[model samples]
Target chain A: MRGDTPFIAGDWGTSNLRLWLCGADGTVLDRADGPGVAAVPGRAEAAFLDATAAWRAADGPLPALFCGMVGSTIGWVEAAYHPCPANVGSLASGLTRFTALGATMAIIPGLSTRNPQGAPDVMRGEETQILGALASHPDLGIGRRLLCLPGTHAKWVLLRDGTVVMFQTGFSGELFALLRGHSVLGRGTDGLLPQIGPAFIQGVQRSLTSAPLPHLLFEARSRQLLEGMSAQDALSFLSGLVIGADVVGGIAMAADGLDGPVTLVASPILTDAYAAALAATGRDTVALDGGELALAGLLSVRAAILS
Target chain B: MRGDTPFIAGDWGTSNLRLWLCGADGTVLDRADGPGVAAVPGRAEAAFLDATAAWRAADGPLPALFCGMVGSTIGWVEAAYHPCPANVGSLASGLTRFTALGATMAIIPGLSTRNPQGAPDVMRGEETQILGALASHPDLGIGRRLLCLPGTHAKWVLLRDGTVVMFQTGFSGELFALLRGHSVLGRGTDGLLPQIGPAFIQGVQRSLTSAPLPHLLFEARSRQLLEGMSAQDALSFLSGLVIGADVVGGIAMAADGLDGPVTLVASPILTDAYAAALAATGRDTVALDGGELALAGLLSVRAAILS
Candidate 1:
């Protein structure tokens, strides 16, 4: 089915648009990118064409599906956000279509949850990974499961019988940046944690406990100024705080008693940190690569539509 | 009683020191400042003398006492920190003596608590205000109460019948500065929150319930860029989140179902913000000006030793 399509995968985000030219077997033939959703609101299609100008096949009529934030309100086309308890069944509403670079493109919608008294919770990019997860783990598509997706956002998502039952997002990256640069706890030393002694692990364990996080953070500076905890140690402590919070909070909400095996889809660094946190909590997890999941997800969606 | 002794009230923190000269009746007669604990160690008495060189009187022994971080480990002289449960019966630790400006000076020690885990919960300059609260509102010292002294480091303190039960610190002001300068939400309008209209109130309200505060901040910014929430309003939203979190998370543990009123001691602007938060939560509070409370505390401690 993908033979009719020139290429199959796209990871569209707030800041960048990445598209691939693939063979029928999904092998990378070529690739092109341009100003992402952030730069082009009304002219997303035009921008994509402009970027892919000379390389785009003259008469391919290639049909490609896009994933990530492209389906957001700010994307090339808006895709209706599917709510939690979302699976293949909840994917129908809030779909927007558009033509860009002479290729038929569809943006995938994220998920949403209506808070009882405030704004609703909404997401844009992680849905692709869920589809990919379902593709690789066929047994998980129809069962209770916990999926942890890591990035600027670390989402702890729960699935009940293949449907996303609930989800929560934490600002682990933002916190890491804030603590590393702006906060007193930040040590100016870069790449200090991943190469050190037990500092990183110590921080992970320290943050794993349920002590009020902020109170624990105050010590990051106080110890340095008072009891002499070093800046490097402080940085690790801060990192631990964010990672610990994400792992503990996300796991608590997503695992719901750890009834199911956990699947973590993220970069290696993140997986290592999560593994460290898991060890502290005496829990085990399955770590998967982000790129692989992303490709698998796009292929699955394309197959479902063609059928 | 109102004789020749010079009265001094101090606002001491970890970084700097400010002292007010007063008559026995607590009337302001002059003012001075010093390098504080951080700038110089083992030389607090000398630096203090230098700052007050112009104001030093040739009269009888200038009986002067000081508070703040000046008495911390890095300050002029370390005062003997007393364990809390500080009732009127047992005043905060006695002031230690030091030679400064060729005169007798007393440095008031902060209060510290020994947790069950054996870690010390310490307070320096803030103990002066707590002492003042006990002197001014004896009823507050008689039972379990929550006292909020809002400033750079807003301390939410709990007391059980005059014993310092426990306390937590929230850096609302420090956070305000960090967010205003470092983060994307830093583009706030100049000055206090009251000038910002509903954005200020709404911001504070949002912080109380916002799931992940940092992520929610983008809405404050983008709502203006894409949805038109206003720049000044966006800034206020950021402020509200920090202040609101200060109010909610700072006391989440100490004030849970605990009976009695919340007493707030801070400047006018912060007091108003706290009042707004209290109103949002349907909790009425007794707000006393920070300067006045510190003065009251200085006098009470002065009387205890002088008599």
Candidate 2:
């Protein structure tokens, strides 16, 4: 495969899908989105074809590379998880290859590792993001680095010389969603948006204490009843508490004595929250766009496969 | 107000209402139930009147005493929170009295106190349960005691000479329910009942570490995916993690340096789970029936009012 040959790349997850049509030099010529693996279930191939129908008709038989839950049991094809201490080359080699719609398609294997607690931890899409981060920043490939990818199931990865040594998964994002959408504390917060204001800072600082999360979370409601904290502030405060707990836990599990600015691979919104949280704990952070990193990661794997 | 004077007592919470028709001596004459305060909203008085219609017809103008969310803002009347360091006498004096359907009615004011973290904590029905526990066991009233009332918002209460001096609330039960009912970890667990088996013990033990909660919780999903853990065990494990975190946090907040077995004021199922979690940490537990305690507490309040 030539570097200039057009290709298709995607980062398909549980809830959404993003696909890019790239030129030989990895410039995104076009992009499309379709149902996530969860939505398509047994029909991932059909969904993928539908999402890229225009691109396929225009370009004719462009190879496709995918990462994330699209490789899981529920995905188009079950790609076996590449055991950690994995880098771009390992992931590329472990990719699950198949022929779909008369074109070569491969799903990048997710990474699996044992967390600090010796419990099994796994990452699907975030593995590609971390790899992309490493590819974009050569400096990050040196020595040791800690990367925090905030999402529905946030991943805290410890990288040694650009290889993912270990990682831990935090249920913060999903927990926050469930709480805000369903819990009692979220009762009157239907139209409210969480702000990075005093309430959030207070929640972050409160989460830093020895008080357990369950106890602290109730403050979202108690404060409203007792101190006149508005429902909007309450939502932000709840967000802070959840994210702060994740940061605290992630640092404990992955950072430890390792010294460096925690690399945050996420969108602007998540970066703002995570950066603020890390800053509160007196840790520095360097931000990277997760979307771009996913593309770069796919390119790196493509380079590896071609080589 | 003699001990054998027939009266109506009820515990009305967010989801359901439980009412008892008791003899003057506090013996149960009959029992009935109705929608909780949350269901009827501004029509709590009507709901109460409807639930107790049969009891009222059988026994005319029986004085009624209620506790729990019935006193909350959403309940029948907005009973003000009685500030703690409070005992049965203080609570009796703090009762929010009213007349509904031409009968003398009272709603026990919930207790309000600042948790160790200096955050506001409040409880409605649990206060009555605590008072009932004290009345049923005089030994509990003489010393500093720690009581764990497990429910939607589990309460950890510290008692000094029968007065609720301080307390903390853990959102463990609600979190567990939310995760089981809504989160990804709960998928495929529709009909499976959580058992206190190896997975639960493992979860409890896992939560005892300093790894923080969000990280520990994800193990339920990861273990299932990678280690072949069943949905049943995963639900139990998830339950253990949430409950264990609460127990750990509760002890740190309310039971610090306090001696004697932790008194668990809850129903049998909750008792089983809480006891298992506490026992894993070498903490001794004494279980008491929550329903019985509610009745006993109501009787104590009636006695105090008469005195």
lDDT of 1 by residue, A1-307 (tens): 3355465467788888777767766677777777778888878777766766655656455656677777766777777667666775346333355665456666667777532224445567787788788888887776577878877766667777777777766656765676677765565556666422366666666555544444455655554654566777777766776677667666566433645567888988877777777667777788887766766777766666655
Q: Highest DockQ: give the candidate number.
A: 2
What is residue A12's positional error in candidate 2, in angstroms?
Answer: 1.9
Off by over 4 Å in 2: A1-4, A253-259, B1-5, B23-27, B253-256
Q: Determine the iRMS, in angstroms, of model 2.
A: 0.8
| B291: Cα error in model 1, Å | 2.4
Local accuracy of candidate 2 as per-residue lDDT tens digits, B51-119: 888878877777789988888888888899898899989998888888887777899999889987799
Candidate 2 backbone collisions, by pair: A3-A24, A4-A24, B3-B24, B3-B25, B4-B24, B4-B25, B5-B24
lDDT assessment of candidate 2: 0.88
Candidate 2, B89: how far from true, in Å?
A: 0.7
| Residue-level lDDT tens digits of model 1 in B164-185 | 7767666566656666776655
Please provide the root mean square deviation of candidate 1 (C-alpha atoms, Å).
5.2
lDDT of each: 0.66, 0.88
Against the native complex, each candidate's DockQ, computed on alpha carbons, is 0.22, 0.85
